[model samples]
Each structure stands twice: as structure tokens, then as C-alpha cells.
Target: MTQTCLVTGGAGFIGCAISDALTAAFDTVVAVDNLHPQIHKTGARPAALNERVELIVADVTEPGTWDEVLAKHRPDTVIHLAAETGTGQSLTEATRHAQVNVVGTTRMLDALAARGIVPQRIVLSSSRAVYGEGEWLDAQGKGHYPGQRSAQMLEQGQWDFPGLRSQPFRCAHTKPAPTSVYGATKLAQEHILSAWCLAFGTGLNILRLQNVYGPGQSLTNPYTGIVSLFARMAKAGKSIPLYEDGHMLRDFVFIDDVAAAIVAAATSDKSGILADIGTGDSLSIAQLASVIGDIYQAPPPHVTGQFRNGDVRHAACDVSATRDTLGWTPQVDAATGARRLCEWIDQRPEQLERL
Candidate 1:
């Protein structure tokens, strides 16, 4: 008998990519998404999946919605990707983020429990924001800075505590310090998954993805992924807006690579494990803008405004654990991915306005 896989938020960017990959391997793929107009307001629904995949439109937070789908499908694997995901927005709409990210995840786990089916695996799409601003430690490990930023620190890639020598920069792993409501809720969800595994013996795989980018990304939301926003601006012949000095660094992982990692995690025997999914490389906002400009044969982005609240200067994943556990690594570099995205935009001028 072939196995069944269910992917929540399957209509969204990353979720859609994972659903397409799962449909190719699993006998059945059930994609559930609320089709929340807030995240992806307009665009043609995501394509590139086999006929075996079934699309279910429902909010994951509602208990009644998943009960039928779960009972009918009884999926062997559940990849939960549904959530309200924006750090800045989450700061203002804390309640909504908590309702969707934390409450929705709890409901999904509850649905699985009600069916008396402990799925072979449950894969969660998490985020690096759980680390918050990331801890800064000195060489002696005695000094620590939680949320302080300095110009000298950025230049040297080292943060200095008042009384200690500067040390290699490190994000705090001691305790989760979520900077935004979204990050806090994601951390809560991760802990909840861990608790479920310990209490019920369910297998769980948590993947904290970095800045994921590629085609099919909705560009209407400027508050979300930067790559999509930049692509949209370039296509429109408008200068890309730099949020800061364009020095903010981010780990940009291609969508295909992210999908491959999710597939690997679902197939692996690993359980109750949290791993970072990224290319292990950092790119500045300016660098990213230049690459996109090159791809579209357009002028460089015009620096516009300064960084706003809840924005971190830099954040990148280690990816060592991901490599060891999933046996997967990013295949597409930033340049290649940017070019591919530009090509897609060029081919679909009509879709630009919809985004």
C-alpha cells in the first residue's frame, strides 16, 4: 500500500513547492490551506503538481476543518507549514500571530490524536527568528549581549561586552529570545511539538528555514520576503527600495533546496529534532539588489529608508546539522536563483500586476 502525505498551507510559496515534491513520491497528497487573502491576496493558484494531489481549502486553526480531512485521509505523514509569518507585522498583530501559529499547530496535533493515529512523521516548517537577535558572546564566554548593536561590532563581526575582549560572533542558543510575536509563537509551537513527542511517542522533525526565495512568491506584500519584493520592483522598472544602508545580511535559500530538505526530513527516521535549513552563506541587501539588477539588466536599486523596528541587522544558519541529518545541501546559489526568478517574471508580465 502506498503512503499518504498531507501538507498544510500548501497553497503558499514554500508549502506549494513541498506539496509538488510530495505528490511525486507519495501515493496521495492532500494539500490544506485557508487561502488566507492576507498572505497571498492575488495570483493564479500554484500549479506543477500531479493529479493525485487533492486541494482542501480550510483554516488549520479551526478544529472542525481538519477533523474530516484527517479522518478521511488518515495521512501517514503530516507536514505542517500553515502560519501567520512576518516579524514586523507580528509585532503589531501579536494576537493573530499567536492564534494562527500556536493555536493552529495545537489543533493539528489534537486532530491527529483524536484519530488515534500516530503518524510515521510530522515535519514542521520553523524559522530562525526563534533565536531573536541572537546572543553575542566574548572569548571567555563570560560576557554576553542580548539585543545591543554597534557600528564597530558590525565591521568586526564581533560584539564586545563592557568588560571583556571581543569574541567571535554567536547567536544565543542558551535560551530562546524571540524579538517578535511571530518568533515567540514559533518557539511555542516547537516546544509543543516536543511535548507531544515525549507524551505520545510521535515522531517529529522541525526545520528552521532561513530566508527562502524563488518563483511563485507573492510580491504584493512588501513586508515579507525581500527577494520577491526586489524582483517585483525590478520588473516594474522601479528602483528597488533598500530598507537600510543595504548592509543587512540574510541567508537566502532557494525554494527547490528547501523542498528537497523537507522531503529528506519526512523520509528520515529522525524524530523530535530541530535543524536549521539554509545555504550557510550570508548576502547583504545591497549585494542582493545588485545581483537582481544584473539579472534584469536594470540599474542598481535606489537606497530608500532606514531599518525599522523588529528588523535585525544580520542572521544566518549554521546548516551543519541539516547536512548531517538530511544528507542535503543547497544546489542553487543566489545568483542562479535570482536569474531564474527574473526569467520567470519576464515570461509572466501579466502576473506582475496581480502580485
Candidate 2:
């Protein structure tokens, strides 16, 4: 029997990439996306997307659409990538985030069970934000999960955590301490999938993606996509804003690497595999701006003392588990990946107008 795979958010950045990869591996591929206005103002598919894959414009929150699609196609595998993303904005907009991420995931799982369509595997697109403050090493080399940064401390320009001020520390194993509503919602999705998989004996692969950036990232999303945001700000010759002295670190994985891992998870016999998908490298925000700026000749970002509430100080992961589980390792470095992103943006200069 030919294998079929269904991917939600297929028109978006990671989704489109995954859809293309799935097409190469599977005999049948179906993509479903509502084309949210925030990511796609025109509500149209990108010309660069693979033409061989089938597409359906539908919301995951809507049962009517999913029920029909699931019953009709009966995909052998399912990759769930449709959800709201924006940690800082999610702090202020709890209801919208919860509805799209948490509720929508539940609805998708519920629809599958209702239709008796147990896929061979379910690959969930999770985020590193679930780690919240993440793990930090102290002066004595003891790791600690720091609490929330106080507003008063931020006002005083105290960017570094108290223990982590003097020495450098690397991230350890992820212990979820979601600081923002967005993080909490992503954590909820993991729980939901775990419960559903356990109850039904379904194969589940949870991918905790860390700061993915590439050609098709949303340029309009104000709260996330720092790479795209920098490109837009650079094109307009506007000074980029760097929050919290620009020393905050992130593991920015290229979109292609992420897509490959997603396909691997769907096809490989990797059940009960929960891993962090990243390059296991930490790049500070200041360095990120400089890298992107060189590509577009964008002015240097101004380090603003301002800070967003519920933002994590640093995010990186131990990707050794991901390597063992999926036989996947990151191939693109941050500098090389940033250049590819800028080249793509130049081809579609109109994307800058998205902001």
C-alpha cells in the first residue's frame, strides 16, 4: 500500500518545506492551511512551494473540514504544524494563543479519533519556548533554573541573571518551566499528544524546535521571526530594535534542517521519541543582527534597555538525543543560513512590505 502523509500549515515556512520533503518520500502528500492573515496577507500560496503536493485551505480548529479530509484521504502519517507563535505577544494575548495552539491541537486529535483514523505516526511541531528560563550553570558549576526577572531589575538594565552574571554557562537538559503564555500553550500541546498517544497506543514524535529561520519566515509577525524582522527593518533603512542589551542567546536552526527532521520523524520507526531539534549552538541576538545586517547592509541594531515580560533569557538544547532518534544532524550554520534567507528576501522585495 502507498503511504500518504498530511501536513497542516503547509503554506507556511516550516510546513511548506516539510511538505516538499514528504512528497519525495511518500506516494501521496496533502497539505492543509487556513493561511492566517498575519503570515499571508494575500491568503495565497507561495510560488516557490512544490506544485506536486495537494493543498487545502482550512483551519485546524474547524472540525467540519478536518473530519471530511481525514475520512477522505485517510493519511498514513500526520504532521501537525499549524499553530500561533509569538512568545511576547502571547503574554498579552492569552485567549488567541490558547485557542489556536492548545484548543486547535486538541480538536485535531479529537477529530482523528472520532473518525477512527489512527495514523502510523503523529509528528508534533513544538517549540523551545516550553523551556522558559531553561537551564543555567552557576559560578560553582551547579545548574539552576532561575526565576522570573523582575521589572525593576530590567529597568535598572540588569540584563544578566544574578548567578549567571560572572561566568558563561551552557544549557543542560530541558526542564519545561514555561514563562510565557505561548510557552505554556506549547507545553499543553505536548501533554495532549502524550495523553492521546498513550491511550490509543499511537506512535508519537514531539519535536521541540528552537528558533527556526529561513526563506519563507513571516515578515509581518511583530513578536517573532527576528531574522525576517531584521530584513524588513533593514530594507526600510529603519534602525532595528534589540531588546535587553541584545545579549540574549538562541539556537537558530535553519528551516531546511527542521524540515528534514520532521520527515525523518514521520517515516522512521521512532515512537515515544521526544527530542529538541536544533544545532545545539547558542547565537546571541547582537551577533544575529550583525550577521543579517551584512547580508542586506542594514544598519546596526540599537541595543534597547527595554525588555518584554515573560521572555526567556536564553534558549539552546541538547540535540544528541535527536541525532540518536532520527539520525539527523544540523547541516547549515547560522551565518550561511542567514545569507540564504537574505537572497530569498531580495527576490521578493515586496515581502518587506508585510510589516
Candidate 3:
């Protein structure tokens, strides 16, 4: 018997890798992507996409987008990775985020139910933004999940928790508080899929990924990943701008590790499992800038004291449970991952031209 897997956003950075990984496990891999101009400058199939996979160019948010694909393919597994993913941009483009992330998910669910085509399992590429400020510890060592930072607080250049300290985020421990519009929409997708999957007895795996970066990431898309942005600036001999006094913490996971984790979740027998995919550690933004600067031999990064609205002060996940459940662990450290990313960017001069 032949099994097929359908991946939304399959031609993308993480998607392309997953599509390649799926070739060994599934008989057919079908990738549906809109090829948005921001991510795909040519608005065509990316060269990095695996040649063996079938590519379908379509927007997931559009009505009837999945009708023909669903009827024809009837995929056994579905990896939902299609969504708008700009945290800062989400503030100004709330409708676009909701339409694609929240409503777009519902559209897929509706189509599946209407057609009576229930995939055996569905995997969602969720974001850590749902943890909003994530887990914080007070003076007494108690955990607290704080709300979004106030405008006045940011203006005053206060970046940390008011009276508490941040702690490493554990997927099962951290509460979903979602500060950004993008985060809210992603949480909505998780909730929507959870209910639908439960009702239909479909397996579900929700992997809340940390800052995913590596080769094949969009160097042209300003909102894609901070690593790519910094690499571009450094390659251009420009000073990289460090925000919020450069103390903001993030867990930058390599793209290959993320793709492997997603593949494990899709292939594993586990159902109703929610886990965090990361390096299980974090680094300050300033440290990250220094690493990139050293790699490119560019000017030192300048700490701007600037803060973006909807940005979290600290975010790093405890991936212990993810390892136990998905049988996966991050293989690349931050420094090595950054170096690989810079090397890839260095080779692609055409991408830097659009910067």
C-alpha cells in the first residue's frame, strides 16, 4: 500500500527540508505553497525544493484551495506549516495574520470534514510566541507568566520582568498567553486543530518551535529570521542593530534539527502530544550579534536600546519532554548553526542584492 503526505508551505525553508525527509517514509510527498513574493522573490518553485516531490502553487487561505488536491491525493498525513510569520509586522497587519493563520487553518479543517477525507494524522508548526513572556520566576522562586510589556515600560527602556526573573520555558509547564497577533493566530490554529482532531479521532502533534534559522532561510524577507537579517547586514559591512539593550534572550534552533523533529512527530505513533522544539538553551541577543559579527568579520553590532512592540524579553524552551516523546534532540549548537547560515548566505550573492 502506498502512503502519501501533504505538506502545506512545503516549498518553504523548513518545508523543503521536511519534504525531502518524507521521501524515505512516504510513497508520495505533495507540497502546496503560495510562493509569496517576500519569501520567494521569483514567486515560483524554489530550486532547493526536492525534485521528487510534487509542487502545487496555491494559497491556503483561499476558498476551494484544497478541493482538488484533497480529492486527488487523499494524503495519509498532513503537515500544516503555512501561515504568516512576522511578529512585528503582525501588529500592523493583524487581518492578514488572522486570515492566514487562524482562518486558513479552519479552511483546511472544513474542507477535510466536508469531503469526509480525514487524514490519519496532522502536524502543526506552531510558534513559541504563544508562550508570551513565557515562564518567569519571582524573588521567591515561584513561576509566573506575565502579560505583554506595556508601551510605557518599553519607552522607559525597561526590558526584564518588573519584579520577577525569566526561567527556561517548558512546553508542558508554560501557559499560552500570546502577546503578538501572530502568536494569537498560531494558538488559535492549535486550538482549532485540537478540537477537530479530537472529534474526528485524528492524531495531532503540535510542535512549538523556537527561533528557527539556518541555510535556505529567506535572506531577502526582512521579517523572516533575525539571523538572516544580521547576516545580510554584516555581509553588507553594515552595523547590525541590536534591540532592547541587546539583552533579549532567544533559543536559536537550526533548520535541519527542526525539520527532523517535525518528521519524527509526523511518523511517530504519538497522538495528542504537544512539545517544544529547540536547543533546550538560550543566548542573549548581544551574544548572538557578536557571534555573527565575528563570522562575517564585519563591524561590531551596535546596541540601539530600541524595542519592537509585541516582542518578548526572553524565550527558550525545555526540550526534555520533546526528546522523550519525539525521540529527537538538537544536534547543532548556536555558534556552529550561525556559521553554517553565514556560509550559505555568503555563497548566494544574488539574495544579498535585494537587501
Candidate 4:
């Protein structure tokens, strides 16, 4: 029996990496992607995509596209990674984010339902944005999920949530209170899939991923993934800009570890399970700039004091449950991952040409 796993958005950074991991487990792997021009500048198949994977160029938002694809290849597992990302971009392009992240997910579920196709499991690549300010700890060490920061507070250079000292934990226990449009749509994806899977008796696994960065990340996107952005600036002989006093915290998980987590979810027998995927640690944004500067031999990062609306103050997810359930652990640390990323970036100077 030939086992097949279909991955949406399977040609991009994380998708391509996930496709590579999936090929070793599933006999056949099919990738469905729109090949968005923002990521795939030529609107063609990415060279980084694994040669063994089959690529279907189509948007997930289109019902007909799903109908045809589902009828042809009923995969044993569906890993949904096709969605618009970025906190700053989502604020201005709310409809685009909602259409792709929320509507696209529902469209795929509707197609599966129409075809009476229930895959062995469906793995959703969710985001930590769903937790908003996430799980913060006050002076007394009491956990609290803060609301969206006001523009006045941001303009006053107030970065973190007042009286809070910590970030969110695992997704299974935290209640989602998304602050950005991107986060709202992601939470919507989880709800839609949960309802569908419940009615269909299909297994569902959701991984609320934190900041993921590595080799294939889009250096030109200009909207998300600050690691790639900072790397591009450093390559261009420019100083990295540190926003919000350079003290904002984030958990930068390596791409390989994230791919492994997704693969674990796809292969696991868990149903209605939610887990957070990250390094289980946190670092200040200024610290991230120092790492990039050291690797690129660029100028020191400057404290810009600029801030973006809809951006969370801190984001670090605990992966204890993920480790226990999926039997996965992060192998690469931030420093080592940055070194490896720079090596890969050096080989592709064309990516830095526009910088």
C-alpha cells in the first residue's frame, strides 16, 4: 500500500523542509501551492523544493482547485501550511490574511467533506499570535493574558504589557485571544478544522509555532521574519534596526526543528491535540541583532525606538507537552542556527541583490 501525504504551501521555506521530511516517512508526497509571487518571485516552482515531491500550482482559496486536487490524490495525511503570515502586514491587509488563512482552510475542509474524504490526520501550522500578549506573569507571578496594546502606550515607548514579566506557555492550556488580524485568522483556522474533524471523526493536530527562521526564509518579504530581514541588512553593509528599545523578547526556533515537529504531528495518532512548537526559551531582540552582526561582520544594531502596532511584546512557548507527546526535541540552538543560515545565505547572493 503506497502511503501519500499532501502538503499545502509545500514549496516555500518551512513547506519545502517539511516536504523533505515527509518523503522519508510517506511513500508519495504531493505539494499544493499557489506559488505566491511575494515568496516565489517568478511565480514558479521553487528550486529548493524536493524533486521527489509532486507540485500543484493553485490557490487553496479556490474551491475548484481543491475539488480537482482532492479527487485525484486522497492523501493519508494533510498538512495545511498555506496561509498569509506577518503581524505588520496583516493589520493593513486584513482581508487578504483572512481570505487565505481562514477562508482557505474552510474551503479545504469543505472540499474534503464534499468528497467524503477523511484523511488519517490533519496537521495545522498555527501561530503563537493566537495567544495575543500570550501568558504573561505579573509582579506576583500570577499568569495573565493581556489585551492589545494601545497606540498611545506604544508611542510613549512602553513596549511590554504593564506589570507583566513573562510570556505564554503551551497552547493546549492557554485560551486564545488574538490581537492581530493574522492571529485572529489563525485561531479561526483551528476552530474551523476542529469542528470539521469532530463531525468527520478525523484526527487533528495543531502546532502553535513561534518565530521560525532559517536558510530558505524569504529575505525580501519585508513583512515578517525579522531574522531574514536583519540578515539582508547586514549583508548590505547596513546596521540592523532594533525596534522598541531593543528589549522585546522572542523565541527564535530553527527551521529544522519546526519541520520535525510538523512531521511528528502528521505521523502521530493523537486527535484533538494542541501543542506549541519552539525552543522553549526566550531572547531579547537586541540579542538577536548581536548574533546576526557577529555572523555577518556588520555594524552593531542601533536602538531605533520605533515600534509596530499589533506586535506582541514577548512570545515564548513551552514545548514540554510537545516533547512528551510527539517525542521531538529541538536540536539546533539559535547561535548555531544563525551560523548555518548565514552559510546558506552566502551561497545565494542573488537573494541579497535587492538589499
Candidate 5:
């Protein structure tokens, strides 16, 4: 008997990659996505996945629709990745994020319970934003300085210059302090998953992913698609805006690695656990621009802009749990991944022209 998998937001970037991976592994794959224009531009559809996979265009928040999908598919595994994802915008549209991320997740859990068909596993695509802003503790369980200083030590004179510290940061395993509405919604979703696991005995695996970038990413949207935006600008010789002094550090995980991690989490015996999926390395926007320039074999583009509000200065994952539980680690480093992304973008001039 072949196993069936249901992937919510299967048409989106990471979701599409997960869908492809599922089709290769499982006997059947069912993808559910509303294809929201906020992420994918209006009338813009995600690239088609395998022909064997079935696509359903429905919002997960709608209880009626989920029941229909659940009854029709009866999937053994449900990978929920559909949600309103944007830190800055989530502040303005808190209710919207809550509705989609929190309410939609509730609807899915309820539908599964109603059918009395508990899936073998439930994978959630969460975000690192749940940790929120502030000084994060280092691996040694010591409190570190905020922002870039947390990751690196300052020189002798630099220590007194301003933001520099000598001790590791204090990190606690407790309730998250969400800085944005998006983070709050994700926390709520996590709580919902925990409840389902405890109350209904459903298997759950939560993946709190860092910045994931690769090809087929929509570049036209400035709110998202930072890598795509930079690639387009580099190809067209346009100025790229660097949010903040371009020193904000981020852990960029390749899309393929993310897909692999999701698949592993679904297949693994680990349940009711949260794993951070990232390369465990940090790179700044300026450094990222240089890398992209090198990939395109072009001069580094000009960067102008201050860091926007609610932006995390530094975010790198501790993938030990992910490795120990799911047996997954990120393979693509920032430089190699950026080059791959550039190569894919370079083949399509029309995409650059549109942006």
C-alpha cells in the first residue's frame, strides 16, 4: 500500500519543493494552496510540479473546504506550510496573519480529528522570528551582546567603541517573546500543534526555518524575495537597496536542503518536537551582495537604505536537534547557493525585465 501526503501551500516556494520531494517518495501527493496574491503576484501561478500530484485551490482557514479535502484525500501525512509570512507587514495585518496561520491550523487539526483519522505525522513550516528581538544567549548558556556582536568578538579598542561584550548570551527554552504579529501568530500555531499532539495523540514535527533562498523565487516583491531582488538588480545593473547598514546577519538555507529536511521530519520517528533548520552560519546583506556579484561575474551593485523596523539583526540556527532527530543538515552554503540562484536567474532575462 502506497502512502499519501497532503502539502498545504504546496505551490509556494518551499512548499513547491516539498511537493516535488513528496511525489518522488510517496505514492500520491495532494497540494492545497489558496495561491494568495500577497505572496505570489496576482495571476502568477507557481511552476507546475509532477503530473501525478493533484493541486487543490482552497484556503485552509475555511473549515468546510478542509473537510472536503480531508475526506477526499485521506492522506497519511500532512505538511502544513500555508500561512501569511512577512514580519513587517504582519504588524499592520495582525488579524490577517492570525486568521491564516492560527485559525487555518486549527481548522486542519479539527478536520483530522472529526474524521478520527490521525495522520502518521504532521510537519509545520515555522519561522525563527518566533524567538523575537533582544540579546540571545550563546551555546555556552551565557548572555551575549545584541546584534552582530553576539556572533563575533570585538577587537581591543572596538570593545569600548559601543556595542561589544565579552560574555556569551543567555538563551532560555521557554515561551517565545514575539516582536511582530507574524511571530505571535506562529507561536499560536505552535501552541495549537502542541495541544493536538498532547490531546489527540497526533504526531507533530515543527521546523523553525531561517531564510530560505533559491531559484523560481518571485523577485518582483520587495517585501520578500531579497535574494531574487538582488539577483535581478545585478543582472540589470540596477542599484540594490540594502536594509540597514547591510550588516544584519541571516542564516540562508538552500531550498533543496529545506525540502530534504521537511521530508526527513515527516519520515523520521521523532514526533512533537521543534527543530531549527538552517546552515548554522551567518552572512550580512553587504556580504550577500558581493557573493551575488561574484556569481553573476559583475561588479557589486550599489546598496542604499537603513534597516527597517522589526528586522532581526542576527539569526543563525542551532541545527543539532534537527540533525539528531531528522538526520538532516544544510548542504548549500551562502556563496554556492547564491551562485546557483544567479545561474538560474541568468537564464531568464524576461524575469529580470519584468522587475
Candidate 6:
């Protein structure tokens, strides 16, 4: 039988890429999205989405959204990409985060179990957020996992907290130590899905993705995607807003690379496997801002004393397991990806006006 696949958040940045790839593999693909106005105001289908896939405008938080859809489609594969994003916003909108991320995921799994149809495979778009603070090391070169950054510590700009001469250590696929509301909920989503899938014998692939950025990301949203924000500001002839010392590190994986990894996991008959989907690379926030400025020929970002509470000091993805298991690796280098993103913004000058 020809297989059917369903993707939630199907029109967003990563969602669009995944949907496009799935269309090439599956006979039919359907997407469900509520089209949050902050990220997507068009209300119309995204121009880049494949025409073959059907789109249902619905809220994942509402029960019937999945209940009715799942009953009708009975999709062979389900790629759950829908979730509330952002560390800062998640702190402020705690309830909404729980509703959309935690409760929403529970509803999806609940609906699937209600139907008593174990999907051939289910892939949940997990996040690097789950690993709140990156692994840490001390003066003795021993390992450590620091808790949330304190307000006083961040306020005085005492960035590093040494636990008996301990400092930030680098590691990947380490047990998640989520530091924010968003991180907590994402971790919860993973736990919920893993337990449910195991109990029901549904094949599961968890992609612990790193910071994903690319062309389709929202330019106007202030709460997520530093790359998108920088590009948008540059287009408007504004100075990039630098936070902290601009030394906080992160692993930025391109959207196309992430989409390919998700498809590789979702379609594969592989079960009970979790992989770190990243470049195993790291870059500082200041460096990223400077590069984006170079792309637009804009002014260099100014470093401010401001610091985000839940932001990590540094993080780099470990893609060894990802390559070993799925035989997948990130293909797009950061420079090329940044150029493509800047070009995308230039192509849609009107969207820049929305900034």
C-alpha cells in the first residue's frame, strides 16, 4: 500500500523543508498548522510548500484537531514538529508553553493511542534546548552539569560560576539539563513520546536537533532565531543588538540538513534510536552577528551589558551517533548558509518591511 505521512507545524521553517522532502518519498503527505500570527501572518499557504500535500488549519491544543484528523487520515507515519519555541518567551508564557508543547504532544499521542493504530513510525522534533546548560569541566578536568544561571550572577556579569574551580565543559548527547520553561516542556515531550511508543510498540526516532536556521524562518519574530533577527535588522539598516559579551557559543545546523535528517529517521524502518543532529561545531554569538553584518554590508553589532537569563554559555552538537546510525551529516557550512539566508531576505524585500 502507498504510505501516507502527516506533519504538524508543516509550514514553518523546518516544517516546510520536512514536508517538501516527505512529499518526494510518500504517496501523500498532509500538514496541520494553526499559523501563529507572530511567525506566519499570511494565513495563505506558504509559497514553497509542495502542492501535493494537504494543509489543515487547526490548533494542536484543541482535542478534536487531532482526534478528527487522525481518524480520517490514519497516516502510516507521523512527524511531530509542532511546538512553542524560544527560551525567553517560554519563561514569560509558561502556561502557554505547557499548553502547546506539553499538553499538545500529549494530545497527539493520546489520539493515536485512542485509535489503537500504532504508526509504522513516529518522529518527534526534539531540541537541543533539553540540554539546558552545556556540559562543564572543572580545574581538575572532571565533568559537571551546572544548574540554571542565577539572576545575581548574570546581573553582575560574573558569567562563569566555578564549582570548586570547575568551568563549562563541552559534551553532546549528554543527559538533558534543561534550564528554561521551553527546555522543560521539550524534555517532557520527549519523555511522553518515548514511553508511549515503547508501550505500544510503535517505531520511534528522536532527533535531538541543534539550533536550526535558514531561508524560511520568520524575520519579524523577536523571540527566536538570532540569525533571522540579525538579518531582519540589517535589512532595515539597523545595528545588530549584541547581548552579553557576545561569546556565548551554539551549534547552528542548517534547515535543509535538519530536514534531510528527519526524513532519514522517520522513513527508515529503524526503531528505538535517538541521534544528535548537528554539525558537531560551535560558534560565538558575536561572530555570528559579525558574519550576518558582512552579508548585508551593515554596521557591526554593538555589545551590550544585557544578558538573557536562561541562555547557555556554550554548546556544540556531537554528530557521531547521528552519522553512525543514520549515516547522515550536515552538508551546508555556516558561511554558505548565512549567505543564502541573506539572499532570501533580499529576495523578499516586502517581508523586511514587516520588520
Best by TM-score: 3
Query: Candidate 1 lDDT, tens digit per residue, 220-328?
Result: 6666878877877776667777866777778898999998999988878777667788888888888999888776666778776555556666777777666777788
In candidate 2, how many clashes are counted?
A: 0
Residue 297, candidate 6: C-alpha displacement in angstroms: 2.5
Taking the tens digit of each residue's C-alpha lDDT, what string does model 3 give over 1-355?
9999999989999998777789889999999899999889888788888888999899898766888678678888999999999899999999999999988898888988988988999999999999899778888988887789999999999888778988877877788999999999999999999999999989999999999999988877888789888888887888889998998889999999999999999999888889999999899988998899988788999988888999999999889988888899999999999999999988988767766
User: Model 5 off-target regions past 4 Å?
Assistant: 42-45, 134-141, 144-175, 297-305
| Candidate 1 Cα outliers beyond 4 Å, as residue runs | 39-45, 139-143, 148-175
Q: TM-scores for all candidates?
A: 0.88, 0.93, 0.98, 0.97, 0.87, 0.95
Task: Predict model 4's lDDT versus the native.
Answer: 0.87
User: Where does candidate 6 have its weakest 10-residue lDDT segment?
Assistant: 164-173
Question: Whole-model lDDT, candidate 3?
Answer: 0.90
Comparing 1 with 2 on lDDT, the higher-scoring candidate is: 2
List model 6 lDDT by residue over 1-355, tens digit each. 8899999888787878877678989998989999898888778888778888898889898998987688679888988899999899888899999999999888888888888878888898988888877667677777677777899989989777665332222234376888999989988998999898889888888888888999888887788888888888776677898788888877888999998999999877677768887778777888888888887788888989799878877767777767878879899977788889888878988877655
lDDT per residue as tens, model 4, 1-355: 9998999988888888887778889999999999888888878787778889999999999998897798789888999999999898999999999999988998998888888888889999999999988677788888876688899999998777667776556766777888899999999999999988888888999989989999888877878778877777887778999998998888889999999889989988776778889998888899988998988789999998999999988888888888887888998888888888888888987757765
lDDT for position 149 in model 5:
26
Which candidate model has the greater TM-score, 1 or 4? 4
**CA deviation > 4 Å runs, candidate 2:** 165-172, 353-355
Candidate 1 backbone collisions, by pair: 135-172
Alpha-carbon RMSD, each predicted model: 3.8, 2.3, 1.0, 1.3, 4.7, 2.0
Which candidate, 4 or 6, has the higher TM-score?
Answer: 4
> Ten consecutive residues with minimal summed lDDT in candidate 5?
152-161
Model 1 global lDDT (CA atoms, 0 to 1): 0.77
| Best prediction by lDDT | 3
Write one digit per residue (lDDT tens) for candidate 5, span 1-355. Answer: 8899999888888877776668888998998888877566775456656667788888999987787797788888888898888888887878888999999998888888888878888898888878764454555656543432221223221212143322211123423556678878988888888888777677988888888899867666666767877887777665566764577677888999998999988877778667888887878788888777666566765545444546555666667656777788789998989888888887887766665
